[model samples]
Target: MAKYNDKELAETSKFLSFVLRHKPEAIGIVLDREGWADIDKLILCAQKAGKRLTRALLDIVVATSDKKRFSYSSDGTCIRAVQGHLTSQVAIGFIEKTPPQFLYHGTASRFLDEIKNKG
Candidate 1:
């Protein structure tokens, strides 16, 4: 595996988040309704846009992200953000289910009073 430094990894992670979650059109690529993008097409488009990208770097980002923000297809040919999409085009398939007895939600400290009063 090719080694990547922190700067390379951070930059690539930001790039992936932008293209996969927000504006894929910025690179002239389209994500599927499920937000998956063809890895090869993404690489080409990003290169054309003056960004360096590769499968190895993508693998590193997906594997090392603390948030686990991206995932690969079953056959490893496609990739997508796990969540946090700002675009309305993606219809992420989420299953609705009854909440567990104990569920945790993370929020900023400023929201604590509002949550306590409203929740």
Candidate 2:
């Protein structure tokens, strides 16, 4: 059976965190105002940046991340980190959100379809 181990999963998580949050430029991608980036574009950029990334792998990374950091757009075409994008050009919006360590913070309800809020 083919499956990703902890090291691979953690590595991918870090990579995703970097691209989805602080430096989309690392892979030559752009994030929207809400810190969401196109999943397809993210894959392509990661490839360009010398990372062997794929949609499947990305899904696994997002799923297995302990912090529940990343989320997919409603259409599943885009993704973003829950927080820690402070150094990013696009600041994630989190208005009228559930307080107390909003792990899924900035995920606007309107975009909930696009950017899901995972607990």
Candidate 3:
């Protein structure tokens, strides 16, 4: 296995996040409102970013990520971020079987209320 220093890891993580933020319309995967970009898109984006994205590299990054950064289907066709990593004040809904309609975070209610009152 290849080992990376702290700087390299941080750069890779940031790059991963950036790739996940955009959707690859060519591949027909749409990123959710939250920053969950598709896995295929991520690979392509990595390639564009000059990173040699391979199955092994992908597996290594996912395995070593401390924040649980990425999530993918068993088949590897679909991918997204695990959620809640982008913003400390936000909540992420990760229940694949039965996802919540609205994430129930303490700050969310207050934020929603403020939005509603403004409207």
Q: For residues 1-119, could you state the per-residue lDDT of candidate 1 as single tens digits?
A: 78899999999999999999999999998888899999999999999999989888998999999999999999998999999999887999999999999999999999999999998
TM-score of each: 0.89, 0.75, 0.49
lDDT of 1 at 105: 90
Query: What are the lDDT scores of the predictions, listed in order?
Result: 0.93, 0.81, 0.61
Question: Model 2 — which ten-residue stretch has the worst lDDT?
Answer: 97-106
Clashing pairs in 2: 73-114, 74-113, 74-114
Q: What digit string (tens of lDDT, one per residue) describes model 3 on residues 73-103?
A: 7777656666534433224554568767986
Which whole-number lDDT from 0 to 100 does residue 36 have in model 2? Answer: 86
Candidate structures ordered by lDDT, highest first? 1, 2, 3
Model 2 agreement with the true structure over 20-114: per-residue lDDT tens digits: 77778877888888988888888887888888888888888887778899999899989989888855478666778565764445756777776
- Backbone Cα, N, C clashes tallied per candidate: 0, 3, 0
The list of candidate 3 runs beyond 4 A from truth reads 1-3, 22-41, 84-119
Q: Which of the two candidates, 1 or 3, achieves a greater lDDT against the reference?
A: 1
lDDT of 1 at 1: 78
Candidate 2: count the clashes: 3
Error of 2 at 52 (Å): 0.9
